[model samples]
Target: MSAATAAAPRPAPASGRQARRGGHPLAGTYPLLRFALRRDRVRLPVWIGALTLTTVGTLSSFTTQYPDAADRRAAAGTMDSPAGLAMTGPGHYLDDYGHGAMMGHQMLGFVLVMVGLMSVLTVTRHTRTEEETGRAELVRAAAVGRHAQLTAALCAAALANAALGLLLAVGLGASGAEGVTWGGSLLYGAAHTAVGLVFAAVAGITAQVSQFSRGASGMALAAIGAAYALRAAGDVGNATLSWLSPIGWAQRTYVYVDDRWWPLLPALALAAAATAAAYRLSTGRDVGAGLRATRPGRPAASRALTQPLGFAVRLHRGTATGFGAGLLLLGVMYGSILGDAAEMVEDIPELRDALREIGGASVTESFASTVMIVLAVVAAVYVVMAALRPQSEETSGRAEPLLATGLSRTRWAGTHLAVAMAGGTALLALSGLGFGAAGAAATGDGGLFLDLLLAPLAYAPALWVTVGVTAVLFGWLPRATAAAWALPVYAFVVGYLGTVLGFPDWTGDLSPFGYVPRLPAEEMRWTPVVALTALAAALVAFGLAGFRRRDLDTK
Candidate 1:
């Protein structure tokens, strides 16, 4: 090297302004969007494909099941009541009573909730999740612009919504179901995209507000829940309340009935406004930090936080408590409607025919069994999330530090597993009790509550099997841990949708939920429960053994 060249002049170190000279705040957004797409390739397709195929599958079932106008009119009674309106949408769709109107009134609202969830998670994963894992800081250190990450996240969400909307439109239009037009399908799909975009924007703001990724996701989901509640309340009673909710906007589009395109304007407007606000809020905080300040913790740790079990409790307490309360409320809601079960299904011949197949069970008992399937599936979701907590801990690099201090892998993972199992069982029981209590109050059947409570216990073994499957994935194929979710999704499809959508009986055998006897409807059968329990025990044992030998997610 020439001394003269070295001594002559060293290039000036680049200032922050100089480093940012080549691009605007959203520079590199396209590349980041592509990168985000790559990361979510598997997940995105699973979500879209599952939602689309199953939803379109319903059209055939509805067409075949209700072939005539008379049949459709008869089925219309199912959604005519207050409970029906709250669960579905406005009563106007019942006037036309076409399959398209049916999908718009009932299916559209339900699917929007799911679409909103997908959007929320996508935004949070790209923004808050990256920040939590320290990747945002690293990425920002490059030539990447300040707003690039968030813009890219939102773009990715937009892309997903766009794809979903397209698929829905195409699938429904091609199915040639009565009253399902390409134009109406487009409008229906648009409703989903609009709701999704609003929630995606909501997630963006929440991600900026909450320091923890989980907190951000929870906050956004709470917003989705609130919107649904507001819409339901408004639809059932108060005409004004529906106008306040984005979900109401989607429903008010009235696809296949009036096909009112104007209602979607407010949803789109909200999405735009929230997105702008999210961008503005991002400026108030530094990369990897939240706009909302964190409260200081106790100077000393609690004794309970000193052990693996206690630490796990501390980590999972908020989510567990929140979900438990939710399950109980859900159970109560289902129970309240149980006493009116006969009245609810009397005019709907399809339901009456379906119940007749159960032969001896009363309509109310049959109804309770159906409700239990849904409640159990929800409980399974909670358990899966809780069971996957250890993987979250390990991937965050926290597990290694704790393990370094003489903590055995099995003990730590086992503690989390224990929490998952116990929490799942408790959720089902709580929901069952609530269902039973509400049914008893509504129907004047005092014995209902006890029956319901004991009924959920029948599902405990099946939920444990889910936990064990999750454990196996986390233990051996940690990278494939997300696949554990397929179990619950499959269970939901077969257990609930199968019954309603006329999926073949053989399909039920494919899910663990099918093996268990539906509570209160059938006599208690210990053999299946016992067999499931033994399978769970074996799977759990094998998973733990694998975890004991495998390398941790962190060094």
Candidate 2:
């Protein structure tokens, strides 16, 4: 035999007994559902707990801040301002002017975003992502039906959202906020869950259409962004635009006010339609193949992949661009509202303290500072994304080929780490610039533009700490890299919720953001910023050293 013919082909595993006798798909739904639940047990609970805590804390804080009808009205008036209306939804729910209603309005969008993010991540990871990685094929060969995997994933996500909704309702009822009816709280929770289900269905469909998990997630997030835009446009201008967005549908529920039950029907119907489409598409595609065909690539590596740094840049550029654009938009919106902050503060005394905490020498400064903090948070998100790239590349086996080249492990890893650290800084600066420009445009003060641009840079050191930790984890505990992403999330909880709820001082201090001096509010305190930067440097060094010695996972 010829040498090429002499090599034996690997045998395919024997297919298990077909469970669906009549060719009816989804025969193994129950078993797949159970399996998915088992897989997501730890993850789902953590998400639910975090979301519940955020909602409950926000409610408690808002209620305490605005205890009386007059205060509620003042708060409502501030929200009805052009800036707040553009950022949050329309002032429809603000009419009642009660603490409960105000808290619900304040928290509804945040909760829905969190739940929807979790839903998309969880569902996509299990369904199309598993198929892309060939995990689903092995399961399918074991008697799992074609639709069983997707069904199981959707079921798991839906169940998680439902459980979270119930928990949120119960937690809110127990929090002792006045006029907080169970029906209102339940409606609020249900609205968020419904949004999550719709996103899960969207993720399912995107998974079928996108060849890669990242692409699937990006597409789903784009859809989410579109929803937010439509909602914002509707809320800022015409009421009809609100009807077009899933977020608007959820908000239209108006929890703690009218508590409309009917809006949920559309969300549920959308989810159902999306799920049905996913199943139908699944039947038409081969296992591990997406509905969208993969385009052919160059036979050889691109010029961009000639070096470790180049490779890292190529891999990370897309993510950086996306984050940068988001930050820029946020900054612009925030800047547009700078002139209105003084007006808002004059109307609402409760906002005075909040504004003071955010950093405003003047009303405009205070508002700019508040917007900067939010911009900082957004930048921090970019840091987390940057830090997570090491883990992602490692897990995806993309790092293996790069490592096999002449590149040292540390050098290769360092390239990505550097991009993350630097990219985060760049994103923060860009956000500040966008914000400053908008503020300057609004107020006709070019000086405000510089101030806004500088605000994010002030928060850079603290943000880098988060990125460093993730790099360290990627180096020393590659298996636990997933846990590294949780650090920033924890920081967010402590920084926002802890401060608002007046939790123990130590709780806020634990966050890197807490340690970082608030810019524009206080003069530069280089000690803490320098300390955080030092910590980040140390983490990077340790991570690189550790990564150099660790075995690369090819699987």
TM-score of each: 0.95, 0.92
* Per-residue lDDT of 372 in model 2: 62
RMSD of candidates 1 onward, in order: 2.4, 4.5
The digit string of per-residue lDDT tens for model 1 on 320-401 reads: 8878887887887777667678876676677677766554369998888888888999899999999999998888787888
Model 2: per-residue lDDT, tens digit, 1-555? 998879888887544544344244677789888888887777888899988877787777777777778777776787886678778766877888676677656677756777888999888889877876777888888655678788888989999999998998898878778778888878877887899999999999998888788788888888887888788888888889989889989888877888899999999999999989988777777887778889887799878787777878887888888888888988888888777777666755566766666564687886665556677777777777777777777776777876787778778778887888888899988998888888899888877667677877978887778877888788788767667656667766666555456567677576788787666666778898899999989888988888877787777
Give candidate 1 misplaced runs (Cα > 4 Å).
1-23, 347-349, 358-360
- Measured on C-alpha atoms, candidate 1 has an lDDT of 0.88
Q: Model 1 reaches what TM-score against the true structure?
A: 0.95
Candidate 2: which stretches are off by over 4 Å?
Answer: 1-24, 298-302, 347-351, 357-360
Q: How far is candidate 2 from the true structure (C-alpha RMSD, Å)?
A: 4.5
